[model samples]
Target: MSAKTATARPDTSKPPKKGSLHHVVQVHYLFTLPILIMYLVFFIVPMFMGIFYSFTDWSGLSSQFNFVGFDNYGKIFQDDDFINALLFNLKYTVALVIGTLVVSLILALLMNQKIPFRTGFRSIFFFPAVLSGITVGLIWNELFLKVVPVFGQTLGIDILSKSMLGNATTAFWAVLIVNLWQGCATPTVLLIAGLQSVPKDLYEAATIDGANAWQRFKAITVPFLLPIINIVIITTTKAGLTIFDYIKALTDGGPNKATRAVGLLIYNDAMQGGKFSYAVAESMILFILVAIVSFFTIKGTSNKEAGDA
Candidate 1:
């Protein structure tokens, strides 16, 4: 064949088929469509409806309501129950964050060590996480009411001689203990995973450089675990602020409403008291509060993470 006759054909032939990006994206949307619809119907719609009603005088039983402007917002600040519940939630949330952080981190450290039956120990520690909150609350309620008192009496310990739930002063701590016991389980697991992820060579080098346990932890372990700790903080804060199930099953917001959380208060106002609009307003305030706290927490943690990096 003459070279001139073999002029190369332009590679206008179709390129090898890979895959359609559009098809993948469409498949993902298809998979998520049902969940998106459910979220819209269950959460987003109700949330907007609640916001709308918060500005109105809807009794929730009647179809008719009149817009009251900022009246509900004004009333929220002046309401003693709302104020008390807010304070209690603040206190509870702080304790939960601190307690969960300390307890879980400690347990994670311990569990990370080489020991006999480490897996079994981890399983034992993690058992609480799998239990239903309501079930655990109910079980703990009985213990507080029944078993704890016997131990208290036998030991002559005045604090536990009666159900901690029965005393306003002790009720907060009682709730905290149960929550910490249950709440720490997941965080501990997370921290253990985080601990395992820390490079052994880094620890060895730190030790070689004469860095003690605390120094190595501060310089290495904490930096690595910051993200997980941030998660723990956010979750525990939300749980503390929106506490209802535990309070409901354990204390019922009793002992003169000492443990009446905003969640419980909102429920009472909306369901039993029939202040539906009022409750909606309270809930909106709560939403704002949670948003504010979460915003600050995330911001602070991001700054720390960035600084560490």
Candidate 2:
């Protein structure tokens, strides 16, 4: 019986080989090779080339040019036009971020509740998000410049008698309104996701404990939604700061350059103004500002979250 049992028992003496872990790591690296190659070819190469050409006076059409070093950067700082554009972009981005956040939050809250035609409403809200910025800008431009004027004349509303795009002050707000209408959909979707992720049991418990709606939202909902809110803030802030297409299509950086964003300025410098190298330098500065702002904003928010946790 003992001999039969010994024969039936499996051997347990073998151990894993020393190189097994190394082999596993090598296989994982092989799996990532394609993405690594793509990043190198598309991202790294372009970024290096951009930085290199920024130092030289390389117009878009010319291959040969002398190195201008910091000359372009110096010019950018001294130019009143660049300063005005930068200031304008700062204000525009701030307003856009605030407007988008408020509008998206309100829509998200409304859509999250038990309501009629919820799915249909969500689809309607999200439909605008799939359209291109340039298309939305152009469509709104026509409405503001032509359709509104006609309707205004018919209705006898003198304030809308002319296109807002023709006025420098109102032109910025017009572009902003169009941008918010198109942009808020993404953040609204995100906020809805955040709202849905909140545990119903927690709300029920809060209700049983005599907590009001506002108190429940403050204590239960906000804490759970922090991560998504962080994502929304970072992404929306970045998008707001780099807005270009809408401005280009709507007013073409007019009237009197009041609505010219930094991105449009860069494009004009490279494509229209024929100062490619200078544009490249301006682009580098913009890149740095974005990087710095994104990094700090994300880090600061993350730290606050960690503390709250």
Candidate 3:
């Protein structure tokens, strides 16, 4: 009665032999080793070094420095320029995200329709994305400074006759419009791809069920595009927060520092003022803010997507 048959279990105890497929597969990892090393050396190392410097008083050119604990971080909060920059960044991010999302989604929907010359239209809209932000800004800056005034004079319109960048009240809108023009292109392409991925059958069924255009969009299109929308939100938020080239080219944070973005501030402080450690501290705060915003955006979208599923 005590003599029971034992079933033999397959053995995974032995390691793969040399020259085995498993070993060969592992060798593939070696192909990526160089890239990994480069990333560690160039990016990770510098990031840590910057963080270390942020806690010290390094004038960037100085060979010697002193650690000042949280002095930089504490000073940043008390700085009025920093506060103004932070507020402007928040305003810019909100406007950029909203405008870009809405305009991109609209353009995507239009492009997705069976319209004449859709490909040409798509190309035209996406062309702006290929141009550098600085280039675009410079172009638009000239247009606002020169071309628009001519049109305004011809039409006898006062507001249109002046360079918007030269006015504090209109500078924000001008910057926003320029950013939206270039920024909408990539998001439009993304939303188009997302739109194409949605099952046509769902729309057809919804139509058959007497769902109106808005209803169908709300119930089906929105859910399918949630992931792409989330991506657009996070990316645009980051771009808006770290905006520099455009401001540099367009206004240089001009019109009484009305549009001094955090990125530009960091650049000016580090390079122009030689306050490298302070700039690093600003960058760290910017990084943390971006991380928090991205985390919440992803978490909220993922939850909604999961609930829909």
Model number with the top lDDT: 1
RMSD to the hidden true structure, all candidates:
6.7, 6.7, 5.6
| TM-scores, each model vs. reference | 0.88, 0.83, 0.88
70-184 per-residue lDDT for model 1 (tens digits): 9999999999999999999999999999999999999999989998899999999999999988998899999998899999999999999999999998999999999988999
TM-score of the candidate numbered 3? 0.88
Better of 1 and 2 by lDDT: 1
Worst 10 residues of 2 by lDDT: 9-18
Which residue pairs collide, candidate 1?
none
1-309 per-residue lDDT for model 3 (tens digits)? 323212222244665566454565578788889999999999999999989999999989889999999999999999999999999999999999999999999999999999899999999999999998889999999999889889979999887788888998689988999999999999999999999999899999999999999999999999889888998998999999999989999999988998899998998898886699999999999999999998999898778677443
Cα lDDT, all candidates? 0.91, 0.86, 0.90
The global Cα lDDT (0 to 1) of model 1 is 0.91
Better of 1 and 2 by TM-score: 1
RMSD of 3: 5.6
Q: How displaced is residue 242 in candidate 1, in Å?
A: 0.5
lDDT of 2 by residue, 40-149 (tens): 99999988888988888888777689888988889899998889888988898889888988899899999999999999999999999999999999999999988978
Q: Model 1 off-target regions past 4 Å?
A: 1-33, 301-309
